[model samples]
Target chain A: MTRILAVGRYSDVDAAALAAMGAQALPSAAALAALPAALRAEVHGVAFMGHESFGAAEMDLLPALRVIANFGVGYDNIDVGAATARKVLVTNTPEVLSDDVADLAVGMLIAQSRGFEAGIASVRSGDWQRRGPLPLARRVTGRRVGILGLGRIGREIADRLAGFRCQIHYCARTPRQTPGWTRHGDPLSLARAVDDLVVAVVGGEETRGLVSAEVIAALGPDGVLVNIARGSVVDEPALIAALEQGRLRGAALDVFWNEPAVDPRLAALPNLLPLPHVGSATVESRAAMGELQRRNLSAVLAGQAAVTPINAP
Target chain B: MTRILAVGRYSDVDAAALAAMGAQALPSAAALAALPAALRAEVHGVAFMGHESFGAAEMDLLPALRVIANFGVGYDNIDVGAATARKVLVTNTPEVLSDDVADLAVGMLIAQSRGFEAGIASVRSGDWQRRGPLPLARRVTGRRVGILGLGRIGREIADRLAGFRCQIHYCARTPRQTPGWTRHGDPLSLARAVDDLVVAVVGGEETRGLVSAEVIAALGPDGVLVNIARGSVVDEPALIAALEQGRLRGAALDVFWNEPAVDPRLAALPNLLPLPHVGSATVESRAAMGELQRRNLSAVLAGQAAVTPINAP
Candidate 1:
């Protein structure tokens, strides 16, 4: 009987699939602390959000653990290096959630730029004069659009906006090439050239605080800012100040400075369109993500090389 | 001195353009009432919202009205046939507000599919446990997108969704063979084939109440509906019923069945993403629209052909 652990809360476990394979479920203490020990002790592998890494401190509990299947495309939460050091394989779901997350980024962009909520309030307030018409704001067409970190998501955003006929520019570490996109070596360089700067960079040690004051200031007053990346990449204080002083025209952010708990000052901002980090938070996409995790875990149990191996790096 | 009749309440008029052209600006009511006197004196043209058709009834007011420059795009507001009969040139601003409006449509699509406002409320209510994680509800990709009314805006939307790799199908009066899109002859046929229906059709008599009960029923319980087009295109009561009983998956509408007074029931719906009509609402876009309007008005006053002639139709 193969033991399985679930580190994160998923909508539904495909019970039929596991049962068909004759696998015994062992949910994690963190995930299933309320369950009886008999139910918890039978786990062989753990499934987590974003293929999360268990530190060496927590690795002792899962002596039989062989694989961890993550629920999202981005696997930064799982310390690949640490997992690799312990000979633990990690698998993640990707590509399937690309369009979903990109859709969120663009949706947040429009909501922020156009004041969708404010427009609703104007009519809901029941002031006849306020219900005139939808204001024709300056368009994104033909505007210079800069991508802060041109990875999978960033490239997808570019492809999405291609029909809007925007001039695309991106900043990446290696200065690589992609079709129909201008490359920048640094964030500030990309900022200086575009009317809108979208931060789609990763989070963690190297990228933390990467979108500093200087890069933001370079974007200037007549620009728009968007962040669908993790909360750590941006200098939150700089962004909030720029918004408050009207130095930045508007901002759309899904990820915040802190997870779950956002700064009240940021929340109070009328110029900001704040969202609970919902990049890939769509039912079909999430279910696909979960199923992908299951497949990866099942493959590991079958002694096959796990697809999307995070520890390979 | 040349007089220009300005229609519509614009918050920011292009004072410099009017001043530079040496045209006297008269507010809408004032111009309408005093137009007869101004015609005999020395009025040059009418600067109005996209379309403000001067009927034969108002023909007496502006014998000298050589031009009618539309303030925005979509010239249906103006009686172009009447203007053409009077030999008054009509113009509309084109290619300016396309991207912004397209952005609005896509925003509505994402917001509805992802349950954006509900997700936000879940966080704001301090009921974070109820919310899903990085993977969200019904995604944007891979949906069979059926666009009702495939004009410029619809084309723009198709282009934007190209990256998502969605199967695109559209309905129009005459079959259009545009690149990268599959055209369906009728709305019912289009709705029958897709999980998502986006109303990007134009407004007015021809298109009013276009999305009928049959079409909604065809979309079924798992289908998502998005309306950034005129509200009159959809059947309100039918939509509400479909939503209430879960006959349709969800809906996102920028335009309401009625202006200012949305169906109170619709506003209270959990399966709806309701917004005030915010199509083309963006600062830069609005400014550009104003600029175009001013230019058109100036062109008419100068006795030149307006760039976009609504009266041509």
Candidate 2:
């Protein structure tokens, strides 16, 4: 009888680690659903990964489930409220991946501002020598940077940008005790103050469409938008429209509303730099995340509280 | 009479600035050479730009030439030693472009390590959703970064990497007083000490091929290389071979040995992230460089000492 189920297609290293802990592994939710009811009932703890939804119906199938330990920081896919209502504990891996996510956010801002797309293309098309120098790129240093939601990841992003000598401005519900950083009352005011706006707010209903059309417009034509947070934080349709019309200068995005399925229209725009949700995808960060997730599972399975618990049980 | 001749194609802003100073502009070296003897003799101060060779032969064409004020930092193309011997003062715009070059170097290192080439391609090819997830990229923070030459731009790169919490190691002639940074005796030693090597040495015979095959090998298969210096600083054939064979993990190069005409073999390699020589290519830096060059030309024409003289007359 299996006491733990590792759900998701993990790396070989992670898979081997889970196997050593005596957990049975399934590639996806579909695979878990196909398992016999007797085997499903045996699962008391789940090591969940991936962006697939895990709702009340799925939780009902595993009646003996006591805890769900997410492999990443975000638990948007899991119904944490339902899990709490069912007396099932939930935990998420955070802090371990903050640095990596912030690093990527800073990198994307610099790359987009410096025109890596045109620069690389010029070399590939044999146009550098043929057409003289490509047009000059905009400078990245000393610009005003606005971070929406100054949480752990947002603070990390702001810290990195400080090294570039950028003026840091941010928007959140309440002002934190951060020295030398300007705090705005709302997203629009933050956008107006900065040359570039990076979204680092958490996902889910509260933050859905937080960066409205007015905020995007306030950033202006010379402004840039970078999103390392979930795509739901911004108005995706408004963003696509702004980019298409050249109302906004450029945008570098790592997440989207219906990701793994980026809109072809957004992809075709030259100013939009699309990255397929690769924040926290580095080897070091992923390994740390996996370890944290395992530790949370071990604690719960050993008849103790989860270390990084997301809900009250 | 054209007392000041604006050399090479310049941006409209720069061109207008030159015209406001009552300077006559020529499109290229060839165009200047084709001018009548009287017109060539009238030119005394040259606002020189571009990478075309401007040596004794070009100097001989303008016998009355008093100064050659280069628009960019590197004066390798101007033959400064020749200018000194001929008693024709030379000035290059330095310090102005260092920040831009350093910014690009850091950006390239992060982009290459993050698998940006594949990430951008997936979006463009509409394979993001189809190809579940891109491979895990190596982490950028907390890695050892080796700088081949710790000059002005190298120091800037090191300073930026320090913010990322990287271990900074550098190779230079006779160590300077740098605290909390490792000093390597040679290029090979520097490569051995770090996970990534960024070339920032100046160009010319003394430093050509400074990053030899031995140095590249010392960096090993897990290592990366970034070049913002002149193409001559690195051995192109050796670099291409190492990257193609996977002897070196990857390389992000902004300069090439024969730029504007990159080797097709190097262009075809997937691991190589090629960028046209754009080290100092930004509106802010270029404007500053252009202003400095014009200042050098204006001072020399008024029988005053040039501000940033590169060669003693």
Candidate 3:
């Protein structure tokens, strides 16, 4: 019989469903290390939920673990190198949440560009009639938009934006086969080419601090930055400074370097539209992610190939 | 020489441009009525702005006025019947602002569904990490969306929503030739068919209170109402009552009946997402509208056909 270790804060419903799938619900990755060897030795798979660091040390505790299935498209929290080296397969839920994330990215861009906060405040503060008219917001449609990464989620954002008549520019290692979209050589160039930039790059060592100070500077005073990707990809201090000085127009961020604990300065800025790590937080996406995670766990436990494998065994 | 009257609050730049086009700039419609008979009688075209009523009385004052080129898509402020009865041509700036209006509508829907306010507050109040997790937001993708009037803006919204995998349904005077969209005969049937209803009907007497209490009741507790059209189209008191009683999920409104002076009750509702009447309040859209209005004014004053005519001469 296969035993699975489920980690992270799962809702009662999710926990119950995992229990039905025969997963032993462990609240945290730290809890797995504290488990009795007898119990840990029987665990063959992990149904992961939260952003807890899982490295070689944690992997060593689960000697019988054959697979780790992540509940999100971004699995940066899980050390794929360690899992691959240990011959453990890693799978992630992708495509399932792409629409939700892309939808948020487009929505945030429009909200920020359209000055939704001012609009809301106008109504809430009862200053709308007194103020006469709110300031005109920059247009979202027919403007130039740059996509940081032209991956699955990025492509979705770009495709949605194309309908708005935006001229699309993107930066990737190599230009893709997309027609009518301009390709830039680097992040700075990409930022310079468009009025708005949406970061959709993957997270990790190769892409860490990819959107640097130079890139932010190139984005200029009237440019808006929207980050639906990881926080590590952006220079937090530089971003805050630029926004404070009014060098950049605005930002709509879903991720942060120390999320949940986002920098107070970033939060205080009226121009910053901050969201919890909710790029894929919709009910439909969450259920699909859970289903995909379960399918991946069940497949590996059943000695079959994982559906959305992130690393080779 | 054809003398043109540029009415309403114009930006200094727009006023200057219209003056350079040989149009007399007036701050208000009342100013036009106050003009000397000699100056008023010479006015052959009016570049109108704002929502001051232009009825038979105003038309009687402008006996020489050949065309009223409205600076917005919605000309509910202009009595088309009176214009038509007097053999005066009425043209509106359409298509130019349609994309901007449609973009805002979709953005507001996504923002409300994703709980953008909570997300913004989570970061602003520095309670994101402390709060642990924000409540799951309803998904925008894959939901059924109903457009109250599938005109130009409605079609644009429906097209953009299709990319999100939403099922499109609509209510119009007659079923449009749009394939794959579910058409209903009345507003009540349209509300019943979709989870979200976006009011895109034209503003005026024929369509006033089109989305009545019966329609709202059909939309139910899990339903959201988005109004990007005129505020007069929706029953504001009924909407506010439903929101207060929790009979409806939420509403995102960019227009109000007495706008600028929005009902404080509607503004105070946590479930309501209020925007200053900014459906087409974007720089690009505003500039395009101004240009279109100028073109229409120039054409009619030059004894040429008016473009985008609302009422045939």
Best DockQ among the predictions, by candidate number: 2
Q: How high is each candidate's TM-score?
A: 0.88, 0.97, 0.93
lDDT of 3 by residue, B1-313 (tens): 7888889988777788899999888878877678899888888888999988888999889888889999999999998989999889999999988988999999999999899987887788877777688878888878899999999999999998887878999999887888689999999989989999999999999999999998998989999999999999999999999999999999999999897788889888989899988988988888888988998888887888878888776
Across A71-132, the per-residue lDDT of candidate 3 in tens digits comes to 89998999999999999999999999998999999999999999998889888898877767
Flag the better candidate by lDDT, 1 or 3.
Answer: 3
lDDT (10s digit) by residue, model 1, range A1-313: 6777555444555544554555444444344545555654565677775323456545545655678777777666666677777678888888877787777777776666666666655554554234466554446667788988888888888777666677899999876667758888888888998989888887777899888888888888878888988878889999999999998888888787665667778777877777777787766676777788888988888898887777762
- Give Cα distance to truth, residue A115, candidate 2, Å: 0.8
Q: Candidate 3, which segments miss by more than 4 Å at Cα? A: A1-3, A32-38, A174-180, B1-5, B21-26, B30-45, B61-64
Candidate 1 residue runs with Cα over 4 Å from true position: A13-43, A50-53, A127-138, B19-31, B34-44, B50-54, B123-126, B129-136, B260-263
Candidate 3, lDDT over the whole model: 0.90
The lDDT per prediction is 0.73, 0.89, 0.90
Q: Quick one: ranking by TM-score, best first? A: 2, 3, 1
